[model samples]
Target: MSSHAPRSPFRAGAGAALGAPALAMGVSFLAFGAAVAAAGLGTGWALGASLGVYGMAGQLVLLQAAGTGDPTGATLGATAANARFLPMAMALAPWLGAGPRRRWLALPFIAITPWAAAMRVLPGLPEAARLRWFLGFALVSWLVAGLATWLGLLAAPWLRPPLLAALLFANPLYFALLLAAEGRLPASRLPILAGIAAAPLAVLLPAAWGLLAAGLLGGTLAFLARRPWRRGGG
Candidate 1:
């Protein structure tokens, strides 16, 4: 029964993986808010985008579209930017536990940071603890990002352009580093290599489609390359 003692998911998850990514997410959202303000949008608009969209890439696309005075393009761009979430959700489903209801409840929080953190940590946790840990980690990250967005909006008047740009690049840089760390594994090597090869080529594609193309092409190539090894292992 001692083995079944209650554990604090919040503490566990936070202690394990929430610190750096949460800070990176907060900085990224701060940059988003600053960008919105610099583009002449109100704080309320930035807050609304943060709350409703909750996607950094999509929010950036929306900001660009709004700046260009193209609402329709913004909508389409945001939608396209968010399309990556579908695959992310699919990849996370198995770890999130089995139930339509649970997945529905959890899917809203399935952003890149939380997903990556959960994926890195969940395999070692007991099955019973995985979902709770994920929820706790995601909740803290979401709250931190929202708060940082608000703060950034308030501070935008005093922030310099270069500093804002650094903030904007923070999360993506962190993510790249995380991926680099993960690439130490044999299976991740091929996918990382393929992505590196495809990224420059993908830039030749239309707006917002390049990332999608790069990911699809890279992932497909990686899967094909890994198949024989997987089959042999099986």
Candidate 2:
């Protein structure tokens, strides 16, 4: 029999991507909006950042850095955080359509996030389905965030800190809920461990460096730890 894997349920569940993933993106965008407003950024600027940067974590980091009078740091931070997109891009490459489609789709990849990528690569999905799921997930993120940022800026003084905090908090909360639902066996534990370890390290290490380390270390450890299919094995 052919060894080709069956289609991923998560991919077919692209509909769900429009749900939870969209909600998460909206919440994060709202938070980013608040932060930008508080920092005295104009609505145009906030929206521009969302459209251009598309990375909630990176955007937040850049804004914080900018608030501290370090545009250089903000630039560096954004760049560093964006570096993680390379692996995600590679994962997504297979599902993308040919030629200009791949190149065009790659544009939004700049804003790729763990949740977005995870939703796109939903296990057990077919290639076409995975592509659709990813596009939907990414589109929702762009729209929701752009709107939220605009709203946050328009509201300004009232929404800044709390909304930003909520947005930041929402990401992990969403992940935890998802993990709780999906994390039953030992094999699934590696991502959970890496997720737990990632945040604190992201805060400690230089922006994107933390993500890179976690991905490498967590992936390597998981690979090494795998055995037969009894309890845990790939």
Candidate 3:
């Protein structure tokens, strides 16, 4: 009865809304709210930063750097840390349409994480429904995160030290949970192993440089390893 095949990527992207992604985001926002409040920032400021930046780790780095009296350096460092976004932009090009006009319009929407992930997986989905699926996932993630941030702001005032500690733990715990969930994916072991190898270097190198170096080195190794395996038995 349908004109097109079913789209697994769309379903997977949408499924995240009901699973780990949503939970991780919600918990992270709660922790971020408590931390920002404890650091003496205004609620409006926290909300504005989250809305504008949309990257939790980047926002935290900037907040810590600026609060310590290096606003300019912090901004520059944050910009550097976010350079991974360039690759993400390239990834979105196909779903956004190949035309220049469409590309320009798609730029703003690129900030949405769900859309970014959907783009990565959309090639495996039904061609006709890919865009719709991407939009659905992006909209839901955006709305939910926005609402959670606002709610967290309202609740921040009452957050005791114990509660704040609990909130802080949520972030790391969620990341661990996400890694566990991703174990089922093909080639997932590569990222897990790379992350393990990079852990010490992550502490030794400066924040921006460490992230960039790890990404480049790990990606290069992964690509080189896969090529030989793909070519023939290696």
The clash numbers for all candidates, in the given order, read: 0, 5, 0
lDDT of 2 by residue, 86-166 (tens): 665665565554454544664574454434455435455654455555555565556777887777666656765655677
CA-lDDT, candidates in order: 0.82, 0.64, 0.65
TM-score of 2: 0.72
Which stretch of 10 consecutive residues in model 3 shows the poorest summed lDDT?
Answer: 105-114
Clashing pairs in 1: none
What's the C-alpha lDDT at position 80 in model 3?
67
Per-residue error for 145 in candidate 3, Å, reads 2.1
In model 3, which regions exceed 4 Å deviation?
A: 1-16, 95-121, 228-234
lDDT of 3 by residue, 1-234 (tens): 575875554464566565665776776777676677767887787776666666776777877887878778988777767666666677676765334553464454455355435645676766655665665566566566666677777787787778767766765676566566566676666766676676666667888667766766776676566666677765
Q: Considering every candidate listed, which one attains the maximal lDDT? A: 1
TM-score per candidate, in order? 0.90, 0.72, 0.76
What is the alpha-carbon lDDT of model 3 when measured against the actual structure? 0.65
Off by over 4 Å in 2: 1-17, 67-70, 97-106, 109-126, 181-187, 194-208, 227-234
Error of 1 at 168 (Å): 1.6
- Candidate 1: deviation at residue 126, Å? 1.6
Q: Comparing candidate 2 with candidate 3, which one achieves the higher lDDT?
A: 3
What does candidate 1's lDDT look like per residue over 132-171, in tens digits?
Answer: 7888888788888888888888889999999998888898
- lDDT ranking of the models: 1, 3, 2
Task: Give the C-alpha lDDT of model 2.
Answer: 0.64
Local lDDT at 22 for model 3: 73
